[model samples]
Target chain A: MEVVLMDILGAVVTFLVAFVVGMTYGGLSRKITARVQNRKGPPFYQNFIDAFKLGSKKSAIHHGVMHHFGPAFLMVSSVMTLMIVPVLTHNQWFPNLNFQGDLIFLLYVMTFGPLGMALGAGQTGNPNSAIGVTRGLSQMVGFEIPWVLALVALMIQYHTTSITGLMAAQAHSGTWLMFSSPFAFVAAVMAMFGMFRYSPFDIVGAPTELASGPISENGGKYLFVMMSSGSVFTFAKLTLYVDLFMGGADNLLILLIKTFALYLIPVLYGVTTPRYRTEQAVRWFWGWPSFFGLLAILQAVFF
Target chain B: MMNDKNSQKIVDIIQNWARKHSIWVLAYGTGCGAIEIPPTMTSRYDAERLGVRGAATPRQADVLLITGYLTVKTMKRVIRVYEQMQDPKYVIGFGSCTINGGMYYDSYNTIKVLDKYLPVDVYINGCMPRPEAVLSGFAQLQKRIAEGRANGAQQYKDNLEWYRANQKKIIPNWIMPDYNW
Candidate 1:
């Protein structure tokens, strides 16, 4: 019973941290993007206000049960992923649930929300929603190859699939995987560009085209939950990247600095580039990222 | 029991304050006033500082800006879009055209007055109001929201019959679900 209670506590803490920090980072990105375009952006707490405002809005209509469950499924996937990814290497402030899962399990868990979102959008009967889901899923297929290969290479290199174990390996080696397994780092970082889904790759929710994509039919509190889930999911993905490549940070400040730096990789790339058609984006990912993934694997095997 | 009600009131106050600040306008380019929106939303005027941004759909939009003259044909579509939006929504009648049809006053197809069809919380004047006027209109809407006076959605609900009657007269081949939600 005591162990179970601690697990629950850990999950709660992880979610809260992910939610707060994640939303702040999202607002900061908006601010940075605005500054790059010569505009004064909203406050760093703007997302918080938007979330609260959305939650407060009265009236929500649903097309079906799937529409109602869409955000719920997305939120669950986010919280579950957060629970399994270790926050700090070996500290006790907020231990993760990694003992129950591994890199392979996390790979499947992370995809759950998008699939659920697609299912929900499919049921909404909106053509735009359907198109967005199709584009998002195709893009998912494009990026997952290199991302999975990069992870497979690391699992082989470290001889363990556990995320905490990977972190420990980096700590013991006194170097980030980015420095040691540079190819995998390069491949993963390239894959991260797609994961962030900024411009060129932002076809899924291309507002000018699909009217905000799958969430076009969703509004009010439903949108509120989806937005919050997005913030949480963003944090979880960024943290996982940090733990895998950057030697996991020993402190909160270090974690913030590393994650924010990694976050900029996609943000800056999105700013300068125009959007890509879905097919073009899919082809681009398959061409270069897959090659880097193969090279990373070969390097690991030889060395 | 008293604390429960008090807490609910406090929560309402906070929600109202946030809603007042973060008004997501629906991105529908109805007329020439639509051109003025880009300046406000983008680099120069930077309406993001005021916590207002464009929402891609009526579902996500808090404010619907009727940018110019609405033709009889488009009025049906606008009504449908308005009904699709969730509660706690506002409408801003943009330009003299929306207020009194501007130069289009003589045009038979263009509606002379907008308020007959939808509840407009604010009306921005000028042939095409500048971005500053648009921003000021938004500021007034926010003030109305804070004071709990921006209940146009509720007003629509209460006066649905009158609105539908007016809407149907102008729109040939009218078909709309009854206003309840």
Candidate 2:
């Protein structure tokens, strides 16, 4: 009974930390983007207010049961991924559920929310939502090739499928995987661009063209749920990358700093670049990023 | 005194506060006055700093910005869009054209008074209100929302028959689906 209670408490703590941190970082990214564009941005807590306001709005029409419950489905997937990804390197405080999953599992789990979201968007009866979903699924296929290759290379090289084992190996070697296997890190970061769905690669939900894309029809509490889930998912994906490449962090502050540093790669890149057509984005991912993934594999095999 | 009614009032106060701070305007710009929106939203005026951002659809929007002169043909579409929006919504009748059709008052199609078909929560009266005027208009709307006086949506619901009658009187060929929402 006591063990079960402790586990529940730990899980709640992990979720709260991830939620608060994730949303704050999301707001900060908006602030950063605003500053880069020569505009004074909204406060870092603006997203919180937006979410709460959206939540308070009265519920309106829905297409069907699938559309009505889509946000709930997406949230479940998001929380599942967060539960699986370890936040800190080796800490009792962060008690992540990494013990239950490996890299392969995390790779597959990340897609669950998008699939659920796509279904919800499809049910909205909006043509733009359909177009957005198609672009997103296609982009996923394009980026996953190189991303999977990079992950497979690291797994083969480290001789462990588990994230904790990989981190333990890094601790023993006294070097981050980023420095040891520069090619894999390069490929992964490039993949992260597409994964982050920033500009250039942001053809999926092209806001200007598709009117906010998949979630175009989503609003009020539905949008609020989507925003909260998105923040949590963002933190999970970033933490996974940090754990996989930057050798993870020993403390909360270090974790945040390292994750934010890792986050800047996509964000700043997005700010300066123009949008890409879906096919162009797909081609871009399959071209240089795939080549780097191949090189990383060769390096792992030979060295 | 601290009963369910009191608690409901407290909830309304909190809800009103949240609604006032975060007003998502639908990106549907009606007519020539739409041109003024870009400056208000962009770096020059920066409306986002005040928690006013553009929403992609009516479902997500709290404020419907009727930029200017809504013609009889466009009024059908505007009414449809207005119906699609969720509750607690407000409409801003932009420019003198929306209030009394301005120079377009003599024109056959231009809607002379926008409030006849839909409630205008705030009206920024000018042929083309500058970005500063637009920003102040939004601030005024926010102030109204905070004071819990901006119940235009509720007003529309309460007098739905009258509003619908007025709307149908102008739109003789009303072929769009029922304004059920």
**Model 1 chain B lowest lDDT segment of ten:** B172-181
Top of the candidates by DockQ:
1
Model 1, A1-303: lDDT tens digits are 988787778777778888999999889988988999999999989999999888877756768999888888899898888878888766666778786237999999989998999999988999999999999999999899999989989988988889888888998999989899988988888888778788879999999899989989999898989988999999999999999999878888899999999998898888889999999989988988989999989988888
Model 1: per-residue Cα lDDT over B1-181, one tens digit each: 6569888788768878999989999855777788999998999899999999999999988999889889988888888888888878999999999998899999999998999999989989998899999999999999998888888888988998898788888887877776556
Q: Cα deviation in Å at residue B44, candidate 1?
A: 1.0
TM-score of chain A of each: 0.97, 0.97
Q: What lDDT tens digits, residue by residue, belong to model 2 across residues A103-123?
A: 888887788788888898889
Q: What is the lDDT, from 0 to 100, of the residue A80 in candidate 2?
A: 87
Docking class of 1: high
